[model samples]
Target: MTVTNTGATPARIRLAYTLPAGLSDAGTGGCAPAGGGEHRCGEWASAPGARFSTLLRVRVDGDAWKRMPLSGSVRVTATAPGAPGVVSDDEGFAVLFPPGPPVPGIRLAADAVSFDISGGSSGLEVRLGNTGRVDAEGRVEVALPAGVTVPTPPSGCTTVSPARTRCALGTLAAGRTARLRLPVTATPEAQRQAPLAGAVLGQLDPRSGPTRQVQMSFRITSAAALATPVASPPAPTGSQGVLAAEAPAVSDGGGGGSVRRTAILLIVISTLLVVFALALATTSLRRRMTAPVAGPSAAPTE
Candidate 1:
């Protein structure tokens, strides 16, 4: 502020000014009295037609700048000794806050993964990167679908619940990336496509706020679908080996036919023996009947 005396005679003058609330003098560039909220310059003798100026440095409160208007007034009182004090009109000024640093940006390198059911223990590497100018500190959380389990979690990660894992990322500098390896085991129930959702909690700001979600999907398939089929071995070609292979089957058929023939022959022989015995008995009976009367008369004469 500059004070000029345009009168013909030298004069004594004082200037008093008050800054707005939430603003204060930054440095002692100008002479002012102490203990008062307002800055006061004591009476000074100014040469006729001479000008005087002093710097008024000020600083704004950080919290107040964000919530309140940036405009304020500075009241100044000027006077010449022995004359009525003159109150100048209020001087208005505008405050401009400096721009804040850029926020952190999140990106996922891949958006989907597929695993074979017979692949045993499979893994997916998720790349998390920051694209802004500030460091990011937050917790990364992942939610896996049913029938899939985290066999080996990434570093600094812990199992929060069934199929849910949380990893603490301490600080990621600008343009840096962190690779998280999530080893998973798939079951038959994990056939169809399943959702795999992940998020970084406190990326841009330290306080809790909205987060960016990285959504992905996964599916399980048969190992045959992923690999080529193996061919069967060719059969043996030599006649000797072929006959040896058929020998047991041929023997089984022949043995069963031989047993059937033996049973039939034995039944025929037993029927013939009974018929021959009956014929011999019939002949002896007939001869005994014819000679029975003569034998009895001879026995009586003796």
Candidate 2:
């Protein structure tokens, strides 16, 4: 910043500067961090027509390398005495750093995915993050578990097979994330159980510790598991069994009911009479056998 006191007398001059994110105080040109990336550069008394310059230095943070949305701005505001009231101007300047490093680190996050069977499609979401300091050409290949299918793929995505899918991401900026959603279909079998899944970084250096292939359990929820259940009827009570053991009877209005009862009574009486007659004949045969003394001679008397 250059300041010239063009007024007749000496004037008090001061400047306020702001540094955007991804930048920090570099400590130069008699500048110090006032607070929150802002600096107070002057409180100088300059003579008439005296010209001087103020330099503000800043350094790019290591974390900002290759990260996206890095359009940072530096705001410069100057205040001095002028003919027309107090003179003040606020200006913004764009600062660009050389292209960030080319290394990209990928970390993946997953959510439980689900869809309807009859509808034949559901929303699929996968979150991918750039952990390195460079922008990356992002892409991912997906192979669905048994019984689920990827039928229709969107633009920039291809259905390599009934079970496999691939999607292209032009460039994923560092420290940023890409959210992917693809439509999918599930078979009846997918609703029965949850499946195991994981991801392995395939680029320059495979993240060993935290970024290593993450193995996680995921399930494709289906419609069958979500169906409502039906209720059952109640059991019969004791009063219902009072006449359940008897033969069911047919009833006619008036005279018919009376006639049926009479016929049942007569049949019971006849059965009893026949049983009594058989008992009397058995008693007579037993007595004749016990008293058979002069059986042959007595036949003459007969």
Candidate 3:
């Protein structure tokens, strides 16, 4: 509420007002509860066009559901010194009971994610969500089980321990969601099903806020475990055995197989090319050998 001094001369003033139900003065500007729900304030000095402002903190008292859709008028009258018996002014007011906004409730989205520990993983991804009416400020912390490691933490995050990571989220507004991928790696013997634990902590001691606890768990798998074994072909005998023994063995689980496959392919192609060239030479020599006395016939014709 604002009160403007529109009079020509600066003078002290007094105010008398009665608050309707659900409306309460916050005891600001020296306004005190006179008696019942009425309040009295001032003898305040003011200049022309100077304004005074105060806040009316409101709340729903008693049964607001049924009492809602109802309104009441409030009359605040101000009088200057020596202006007795003269009605200064009058206006009507409506009482409102708007429900308070919900507190910021930031929580993590603990979705189950699969990660490949056999050199197929860039990192683990963490998702977040908020369920509340206000914005929230907090940090997200992720901890991994042993054998799994964070090669590089996600943006806005840092590693507190070998297995733990924390990412600070300054303000997570309600209804806003986010996802961040944390760079990770694992050894061959790393723990499977990398358990990712997260918690959202509030900023203050419940008055402000931190993140609400939201645990995110990860499931990690290794390529060796997931890969199906391939049966090796029977060993060749005689001449083929010599070549087979010189070539590297094949494995279904590791990347070395890819390299071995290319090398074997090149060897086969080269052998085929050499055999084709030798066959052409042999055919030409056989034709020459089968040909009869061409040199004698040419000499006779000349």
Candidate 4:
């Protein structure tokens, strides 16, 4: 079947095909990598299996034909020479398509990454989620806090630091979901002030590539808390013991000083009251003597 793109704007197009009955070429084009006799696209023209392969030379309005890898359903998009947009399908088939023009670079929203820190000294585990999309290839890196250490990433992962590591996800397809757990060792002091640093999960793909890439920043927080003591402080000895023994006497002296201050205040108040009463009595006696002298003079005149 002949497939053509009549759309003015270039786009990724997909096509599906079924093989005829009773032919078994195994989809081999009679050309393969060295020491490999696997089936190629041309041989599938007569395959009698549930699926079949088709080779179509796609020539854009102004581009040449290019070879792209396809697994199940072939995905072809407007691309440049050498690197063509190729996608796989669920069924078995070899796909051939035309080369696409050099596409303007596309950008993706960096994947949003977060970390969940788990486990302890024996080892630490870093869990990742919310990764956006990386169009190209390079590395998926996670930088851990200072004290927290991660074990080597399982198999496909690489260690970038004693505490940081990465996993190879190759070309992360658009909208793909990836999860990785990194194990590390908690440093001796990690428990006190667990260092919280930012993490970067990115695609190593270069600045200039047909594929686009996105990056995400994850804010990491330390999970350590102060540990409770299993025992209490021990008692002091010798000279220290002597100082402890004098604590009661110091308290008793403070009580006695407070009592003495209260007594002094009471005594001062009593003395002031007594002086005031004496002055009042003296004033009354003078008034009485003066009144009698006046009475004696008044009586003589009468």
Candidate 5:
């Protein structure tokens, strides 16, 4: 009964529908403006059991398309040969929106997030911008379905519950922003080839209370190549040397061995000097015995 432009950017929606019999009138087509409201159009009927097509085209505004993902329900009605009409399918259609800005109350800028299954935690980082009238305190939570695992959220993120990870973003005033890191640790079974579904939720308080929230869902896939983590070259820790917590084997890589060798040599030289001193004392004792005293015996005989 009504047609409208429901996108942030200008868009054209073409809707074609069939009409009943004996009610078709002239000038039966028109356009719906952005943020569509009700509109009356010319009658659409001509004869008994007649079918007609009603086509509507509209240009949507650019800014409107960026507010939210566009979704709508279509209602189709059928009328009897000459009796009242009955409504048909009210199927809904949801249009896709890109992952970046212009969405209400969200700021997805300058956020670094990665997912890795190589023996460590992997998760997402999000930056939320507050544009509402009130300040916001919130976090992001992610869950993987059966057979999938999240190793850990990024640093500074904590797992508050078994399957829920929460990052507290204290308070952000209007036009200001806050950061949230969501880390997850997964079981090995979950690390195996699996698909991951994650969500980011915004809450307004530290204590348990009603939460004003926004969420987005996405998927992560792990391939065979991702079974093992590729080791990254260690970053320079920017220290004078490696800390004690690190490999101490190379503490004195060059000088330590030489110091041990010199110590062994000194021990061997000291032992040889003691042996030579003992030998000299033994030779002196033999020489004194060979030079026995005969002068004392001659003086006694006189």
Candidate 6:
């Protein structure tokens, strides 16, 4: 509140104010109750063209503010030297309680995730942050899609059922973050394009009200899509020749064996015929030798 003396002389001023119910003065700023239940600041002198100001702090009742409207009025009286006592009309004002700080806002870092169904157990870290100005206490409710299994619930979380997991978030301070490691196994039947939903249901401290619900959702992507592609290894040098050399020799069925046996038998028979021919020639020669002398003499006499 301010009081100004615009006259040519110094002035004595008296200021008074009234607070509506559900509000109380902290009794500072030299304010006291005058007669007739009006709070006042005693007479103070203000020089010509000078202003006097004071601050008044008030305490508000939360319950009352929540229940009803608030309004009040103020009056000022000033007496200048050699001037008619100046009186100001009752100035009325309305106190509007601006909306209170909202309940804590729950935020998820990522709204979607991909898990490899064929890959063994996989996990997702659900990071939750409080975006509101107040500390929050609540449970984080997580619902997994069908065919998605939670092998182990995160610490401080309970398995409500096969598809639902709930974890106690205790008290989350404003601007702080918490993490829930949701270990889950994706069955082969787990399908792509599934939905994962999560909610933080709780209350803001120092206020009794309905549980606030902050919901977030995630899209499920196939883990195979997120997998890294493995490159094929290079082939060894000279592999074709090495493979051929190491291969076992194959022969046609019984025909190959018969052909080989026939070749050996023909070779043995040719060798025996040569030996018999040589022996017969030798024997004939010996017989000729024994009869040759008598034959030669008879031919000469003729």
- Highest lDDT: which candidate? 6
Lowest-sum lDDT 10-residue window in model 1? 238-247
Backbone clashes for every candidate come to 0, 0, 8, 25, 36, 2
Tens digits of per-residue lDDT, candidate 4, 1-302, equal 22332222222333333321222233333323222222222222211112223454321221111111221222222221222333221122322222123222322122222223343433323322223344445456665555555555687877776756767765545444444555555554443332233344344353344433333333232343223221111311211011111112244556788788889999999999999999999999999988845444444563
Evaluate model 4: give its lDDT: 0.37
> Mind giving the per-residue lDDT tens digits that candidate 5 earns over 1-302?
34322111122123333221211223435523223332233334333222344544333455533333233333332222322223122222223333443345545422222335364544555666776666666555554344333445556567665655566566777677776555544555443423334444454442332445555544444432244322111321211111111112244567578788889999999999999998999999999989968664444563
Instruction: Order the numbered candidates by lDDT, best leading.
Output: 6, 2, 3, 1, 5, 4
Candidate 2 on 90-189: residue-level lDDT in tens? 3333343332233336566556565553645446776666777766666666656555666778788887877667777557777777777777666554
Better-scoring candidate (TM-score), 3 or 4: 3
Clashing pairs in 1: none
- Candidate 6 structure quality by residue, lDDT tens digits, 1-302: 55555444565767778776677777757788664436877788777567767677777776544432344456666555544435332333344433233434555543344555465534656666766667777566666656666778867888888877788878878787777667767654343212222222223231343455544434455644223221111211111011001112355676488788889999999999999999999999989989746454454563
Q: Worst ten-residue run, lDDT, model 4?
A: 238-247
Residue-by-residue lDDT tens digits, candidate 3, 80-187: 444432223222233332322223454454333345534566455566666666766656666554556777775688889887778876666767766767766765
Estimate TM-scores for all models.
0.34, 0.35, 0.36, 0.31, 0.33, 0.35
RMSD value for candidate 1: 46.0
Which whole-number lDDT from 0 to 100 does residue 198 have in model 3? 22
Point out where model 4 deviates above 4 Å: 1-135, 204-224, 229-232, 235-302
RMSD (CA, Å), each prediction? 46.0, 37.1, 34.8, 33.9, 28.9, 40.8
How does model 6 fare in lDDT?
0.55
Residues 1-302, candidate 1, lDDT per residue (tens digit)? 56655444355655666554577778755446344447666666766566877777777776543322233333333344444434232233444332222233665542334555455644655566766566666455555545556776777989887667777767777788877667767554342222222222223332244454433323223342224321111221211111001112245456678788889999999999999999999999998988747454444563
Q: Which prediction has more favorable TM-score, 1 or 4?
A: 1
Q: Which candidate gets the maximum TM-score versus the true structure?
A: 3
